[model samples]
Target: MEVLLSLVVGALVAAAIYLMLSRDLLRFLFGLILISNAANLSIFVSGRLISGAPPLIEKGQDFPVGEVANALPQALVLTAIVIGFGLFAFALVLTLRAYRSLGTLDTDEMRVAEPKDPS
Candidate 1:
């Protein structure tokens, strides 16, 4: 199961990289989302895919009675997902503003600081 998940993460990363390399800001935003998801999945898979009990201990015990699933990775991934969503939303707004002001989504064409060629 971990192997399969790893493969999926790899594929996502590859696709994300391809999209990130494009000149379009929207494509780059999509790639950023893909990469964020890939990171979350990778973190989840690394937490050891065990299915037994929740990480709660008995009243008399110091730890879980049986094989409990790891909670740290789950928590980390959840937090990361929230953060990633926030970041994506901010980036999307920035992209929209850039498009509205620059009249284009192409990074190469949005060079406001660069002087235009006379030719």
Candidate 2:
């Protein structure tokens, strides 16, 4: 399972990079989302994938009886997910506004700093 997850993460990262290299702003935003997710998945996999027991102790027990899942990675992933969502939302809105104002979603053509040749 870990090997499979590693493969999946690798694929996602590859796809994200491919999308990020596109000339389209929207594609770059999508790549950002994909890469964030890939990072979360990588963190999750690094924490280990155990199916033994939950990360909770019984009422009488001071510690868990068997192997328990790590809570740190889960918490980290959750936090990352929320933050990523917010960032993605903001970027999407910003991109839409830029597209509307600039009349183009292509990164090269949306350049306002570099004026086009009059000729």
Stretch of 10 with least lDDT, candidate 1: 57-66
For residues 11-98, could you state the per-residue lDDT of candidate 2 as single tens digits?
Answer: 9999999999999999999999999999999999999998767878899998888888899999999999999999999999999999
Name the 10 consecutive residues with the lowest summed lDDT in model 2. Answer: 49-58
* Candidate 2 lDDT for residue 38: 96
Judging by TM-score against the true structure, name the best candidate.
Answer: 1
lDDT tens readout by residue for model 1, 1-119: 99999999999999999999999999999999999999999999999999978889888988788788999999999999999999999999999999999999999999899999999
Over 4 Å off, model 2: 58-62
TM-scores vs. true structure, each candidate: 0.96, 0.91
TM-score of 2: 0.91
